[model samples]
Target: MPNTTQNAPTNVEEIATSMQDTVLGIWADFVNHSPFLVMGALILLFTWGISALAARLMDASLRHSKMRGSLRELFVRLLSIGIWITGILLAAMVTFPGLTPARALSAMGIVSIAVGFAFKDIFENFFAGILLLWRFPFEKGDFIECEGISGQVEHISVRQTLIRQTSGELVIAPNSFLFLNPTKVLTNLPRRRITIITGIAYGENVTEAVRVIEHAVDECRTVHKDRPLEIFPQAFGASSIDIEVTWWADPTPVDVRRSRGEVVTAIKGALDEAGIEIPFPYRTLTFKHPLETVSLEKSEGEIS
Candidate 1:
């Protein structure tokens, strides 16, 4: 037996009818607001186009300026960000006619603290990057050593810097880390001084050794002739006395390496040609009573 009541709808039917009505209501609202929505979207698209055009124009206008390439890029990026932020606010207001400036300000104020906490590191890095671009000594293509990482700076962005190491590895370092740490810019000058230690036998003439080293290092192709070479007896060791050889070379890693090799080879060859001895570790042991001597004396006594 089945009981049916036409006046009462089942729960399932009621739920479906409610959903249908809700969807139709939403469709009607969308239709009524389609024009404003389209206008908002078009405004955003136009803003994007303008932002891009302005970036190009700014880059071209400042191409010949004295500002650094990274600084120029920063300016372009900031301009784009400003334009987009304005565009978004305009679009939102147009999309929602009821969202007034005062209401927007209230909403932003409510979330300001939370947003700041959430993006604290992001903002810190952004400001640090700006400082680095504005007045920091090192720039793109400059080799810098910060903390334990050292490499040539490839790019500087709002949040991080890309360093390309001599070994071909790329390191992404935060701008804050670079900003806070002590950075040594190896390429700050066109040339930098490099020192290497070499040793000679105790018997070698100190004056002759110094003279030979100076001549050899100076003859190297990469040695900066304008800068004076320094060769001095640095310290005395167990095996030999260490000679500190210092000269100026090009500040690039490859140039420094090549110059070092050349200097070392020249020193070794010069020392060897001059009949000077390079020191090596050696040990001389004198036993109080050698076994061979004792045995021989005992045999002689037995024979006697």
Candidate 2:
């Protein structure tokens, strides 16, 4: 510290000189190591190209296999993922010849664990969605009731299933829940039976009412003629005779519901046109207590 030389370079000048020497050293190393560097680069490039080409070919082949829609989509995604992962690993090995895949994977284990834990739910959903897509428990345009909601399936994707209800509401349900829970597919059968309950006056003939219902069912356009429709007397109520009419519909729930509405309206109109009396409950009130009887009398008087 006591020695002073004006000719000695300042700290800034010394740092600048050291930087220049470091740059020259790096350039020399690069020139000397060109072969290895070029070789690694070329290997990586070749691996990437091959992986991309293989993934495309596999996807095309799977699409042509005429497999189920869900299975085809899943196979394509899985094949592409596998190819890219393998290619990246190969590229990493080529970039660092001394580093093995085992070592690299081991080093990355902790980070992978942390990431997995952080996104565990997301991973669960993703895997469950893949399973659902592959297995295809349900398909597009199927009438399914799940998670306390009943609707026709509009679309299905990896994350959620879209459903449109008769009330004009769109429901988006998670694929994971659909995969885990029970799903009711109404459209699985070629046709579904529609049940309608109608009542007639107390004195009306039960047999005649059943005949009228049968005629109405046959006349309704929604009723499939291929399937025999059933109309019969079910029970004799206190004030009316209950008649049941059932018909088959080929469409999904929404269509069935619409057709059912039309059929019921037509049946009711036909019954009314035929002078069939549909009765409601007619009750005669008897007073249980004296005070209740007096209140009823007073209310009727006040209304008058």
Candidate 3:
């Protein structure tokens, strides 16, 4: 038999000996790379120091510019990231002499593809947050409404937005949702136009009712006296005329609530004092044939 032992699987002793040789080879390689490793570490430390100093300098320069606060921060962060990335690539090449720029780029491209697939939503939110801070009108402390979520923006970050609801609950919303949907900025302007319906008895004077309602709203402390006030007889109701009352008020939630309350109170008091009736909601009933009068009365009672 010619070398039948060599053809067979290696014995335990032989396996152990081979493993020991491989370990020794790795150890030797590592020992040879010690100096390079130290140099790479030093380079990384220097890079960090440079990045910090550069950020401070950049921030100082940006303060004099009219840039938005969020946008200014973004520029500084991007500059730091670029510097750090360059430093890391240089360190990586110094540590491993065989890692050339082309090779490093290829490797990075492959790794980036894998990472992109693994963190699709994360990247989406990151880009969305960037767009929001860079170009969009959203800012910290602004009250915004998006997809039925109405709240004051507390903080905005790379992946999420912090919104404090009117009921004192904090909502951590993903930036992608806000970016992809329509967002209503309630406080974009100092004043907001709000509307309410006021009804008066059909027999009441329409012109006089309009004048009374206008005066009542104008007297409200929360109403913007300089802004136009509109009171129009909108429609005819069963027992009253529905008038649409629109006025401008402060755009804050607290102010909005208080202003509406004040206007409503003022209108009710003025109408009552002037002997103008705010009629109860009334409905008309008809039937193909005459029904029991008691049933009709009962149905009307339930409707009321």
Candidate 4:
């Protein structure tokens, strides 16, 4: 076949020689540009040092300011990241004069979209934490309620909020839950109004009962004297008339409990001294016929 088999060995040898030449050329180029690689490494090291120093300075400044802990950390982290990224970009440019950071960033953006979808919950919490830190909805030591969680905020972090529940349980709540839902800042106001419903016998004077309750609440030291105390006849209960007593007090759980206790005790004593009865839930039952009579009639009918 015209020495085809003999020519095949020559073709194979040529292919091997070509690959070897390509590898050697690449190695030669790398050796020739070794200085640039060394410079890039030095630049990267300098960048890292500068970034760290800047972060420390930022932390010190933030500590002296009135900024919140979480917010200060956030700013410091962002500053460090920006410094490092700029440094790396400069180093890359030094290493490869023709390298395009913009083009690389565009490629990274496309990859980021896929990563975002895969870690949706993680990113959601991260951004939510950032938002929470930015907006002072509630701060550490503030009592708040969200999604059935009632507690004082212990600490706010980048991913979650640490809540110390009134029951003494520590809850690590995700930031997304607090941000997405409606949060009640219980201690936002200087004073909060507390209401207690007390019922008295229907025979008691409504006007007199109101006076007694109001006077009792006014006597409580914890009750805010500047604020108005209110008492109204809410409704007639099954066995007593319900009176709604409300008074303003310091917006704290401990104070609320103490004030309420004192007010209740005062009201009870005042009502008792006035001979007003706080009636118990009483129901009267009336039967058309006694069980014994019904049973006797049934027995007589069966005999008949």
Task: Please list the C-alpha lDDT of all candidates, in the order they appear.
Answer: 0.90, 0.79, 0.91, 0.89
RMSD of each: 3.7, 5.7, 5.8, 5.3
What is the full ranking by lDDT, best candidate first?
3, 1, 4, 2
lDDT of 1 by residue, 1-304 (tens): 4555753468679999999999999999999999999999999999999999999999999998997787898899989999997887788889999998877667767786788889999888988998888775788999999998989999898889999999999999999999998899999999999999999999999899999888888889999999989999999877888999999999989889999999999999999999889978756678898555458888899999
Query: What is residue 194's positional error in candidate 3, in angstroms?
Result: 0.5
Candidate 3's TM-score = 0.86
Model 3 per-residue lDDT tens digits across residues 81-176: 899989998899999999999998888889989999999999999898889889857788899999999999998887899999999999999999
* Candidate 2 C-alpha lDDT tens digits along 170-230: 9988888888898888887888888888889987777777777788778877778999888
Ranking by TM-score: 3, 1, 4, 2
Q: Runs in model 4 with CA error above 4 Å?
A: 1-56, 59-74, 91-98, 289-304
Candidate 1 stretches greater than 4 Å from native: 1-7, 10-19, 109-112, 284-304
Query: lDDT (0-100) at residue 281 of candidate 1?
Result: 78
lDDT of candidate 2 at residue 185, scale 0 to 100:
83
Which regions of candidate 3 deviate over 4 angstroms?
1-13, 283-304
